[model samples]
Target: MSEHAPVEPGQVLPATELVRDRIARRWEGLNERVQAKVQSISGLDRTPEVRLIQQASSAGTVTKRVSWLRKAADHVHAGAAHLAACRKGCAHCCHIAVTISRAEAQVIARETGAKLNPKAGVFSMADSEDFGEAFKQATSGAVGKPCTFLTEGSCSIYAHRPLECRLLLNLDDDDLLCQLVEGSATNVPYLDARQHHVASVAILGQHQDYDDIRNWFPQGRANDTPSTQHKAD
Candidate 1:
């Protein structure tokens, strides 16, 4: 089959199906790994800080969730070393729109000592007739506004970043494709369509709605207090 050939309705592509299956299996193991990690941390140390870590890990705090996601991403990356191009200091893809659940946002807020504003930076492209143009407009202002957590070209809250950020793994060889100004297309392998659903379930034990990452924290600055007015794009 041609690499660019379209699959007909009701047809299943072998490669696509295999990727989906692999992601599904990895997602299924997240809970087990979380438990194992928590147990190891709890048993290997007996300090007060370690005890606090154990408690938080068992309760599925952002720290534990981040650890689980890192492990899961690493497992998937290990199998696709030839396809993955994500690396530290490569912040090209960070300019795009990022949405996250309320739970995840609250965690970030707590960790960063920032106020959580539910309505800030809200936007929806569901009604757009021209998706590309709509996306461009929606993200135009954010092109240079690196994620609030980004400092010195690195994610300051890397471990506690949103699930949307966690799932972005580029499968193309050209890093330029990740640039906001670049029009080139890039491959995305090992992507599970149900990733958001799984993330919501794992984080909040059910489906949770999302908002833009920029909206979660207060405007004016990363650690600023939230305002009463809502900001939308």
Candidate 2:
């Protein structure tokens, strides 16, 4: 049969149905072992510190220099490579209070058409009452709680996950991020502390405030409710 045959007049397909079909087809191409790996890591437990790392926004300006970012990009890319190999069901990163730059947020919203919950007020890195104070109290920047996006052991907006989300992999121990910075993994270079600090500051300034991205998210999703899974069958 021709791949691009015209459809019958007046026959309509629901967009959601089409999306599900596409999801299924994509998964079908993967080998069984690879597919199984994705599933295995999909719902791993979150460490309490992960949330802090997400919130620890940098408090400075970004130079936007390509060379500096280029150096950091390799580490991120290596980290992402490890992450992509993970199972579909593994969403431990989703459990953290993820923050994004204005650019990242815009891309995600545009791509996924997912709207942030209006109930949760905008989150800001400058808000002394929230992030600043939290920073003072906690050794790590995480919120010590699962992020609101997590539901039913999954991320509600998986397709539009931010850069940080795409970088996480199973650590096997609670202090993974810390270890990455301090460990001896040959392939994985330590992420430059200065670069991350500058990047965080740049993101916060671009948004004019941290709350800008928070304004996009919704609130009051059941804490333990897992997000609905979408994959080809």
Candidate 3:
């Protein structure tokens, strides 16, 4: 899921095969145009993506890199706008885990003056099998909770949100399957933006570990962030 890093004890992502399998299943159902677009995105060169990251790195700011990611997301969204389930005021995806790098958390904390939760590692999507039952319980408990920055059915930090949040697009035709409910599963189809995820990791730094957004802005509110006048729609 991350760009690059030396494999560490608990950092290795779990369920890679499962995600690929799911992508295959989703691919089988996409419309021809959508299928062609997905293939085009998948067929893009990996080297150029890394080069783009290097260029962003040379710009000397994580925000710039993240902004580039947002633009990349916009391009993706534009191509699939007709079918993407994601739209303003529809944020069912925000209720689940949202990962961000430490540097991203720092940027958000600095910009919004939001006190970070300080608790780390517990909410990472990486295989937390080593953390035992506590991790499992926390993962389950986090599923239906609204993000700290979610307010009035919108994200308070939409302009400066994390790459994980930016690239999370539900390719379904509508929001029905994206709705969250306990004891039920959803078959939402999303692009496998692994190349971009890797680029994101590279831009942020390979050494930085990922954590959930709740851990980054535990008590922050829409009003606590940039004044309404400054917030982006």
Estimate, for each residue in 1-233, the C-alpha lDDT of model 2 and write its tens digit: 22223332112223355534543453353345344544565564433223323433331323223223323433443433443423444343343345555545544555555565433334445565676654333313232234455555566655444545544443221212211111121121222234454554553354343332334454522333434551100
Better of 1 and 2 by lDDT: 1
Instruction: Say what the RMSD of model 3 is.
Output: 10.3
Considering lDDT, which of the candidate structures 2 and 3 is the better prediction for this target?
3
Task: Report lDDT (Cα) of residue 191, candidate 1.
Answer: 36
Off by over 4 Å in 2: 1-75, 78-88, 117-131, 134-152, 170-197, 203-207, 211-215, 219-233
Best-to-worst TM-score order: 3, 1, 2
**Judged by lDDT against the true structure, how good is candidate 3?**
0.59
Ranking by lDDT: 3, 1, 2
Candidate RMSDs in order: 13.6, 16.9, 10.3
Residue 25 displacement in candidate 2 (angstroms)? 44
lDDT of 2: 0.39
Which pairs clash in the backbone of model 1?
A: 120-215
Worst 10 residues of 3 by lDDT: 3-12
For each candidate, give its TM-score against the true structure.
Answer: 0.50, 0.39, 0.67
* lDDT, candidate 3, 1-233, per-residue tens: 32223222112134456544544554464666456656655654455445555566676677776666666655544454554555555666767767777777877887776787677545333435544453444445456677787765566776667667766776655444455534544456675667777766666675655667776677875454432221112
Cα-lDDT of candidate 1:
0.47
TM-score of candidate 3 relative to the true fold? 0.67
How well does candidate 2 score on lDDT at residue 205? 54
Evaluated with TM-score, which candidate comes out highest?
3
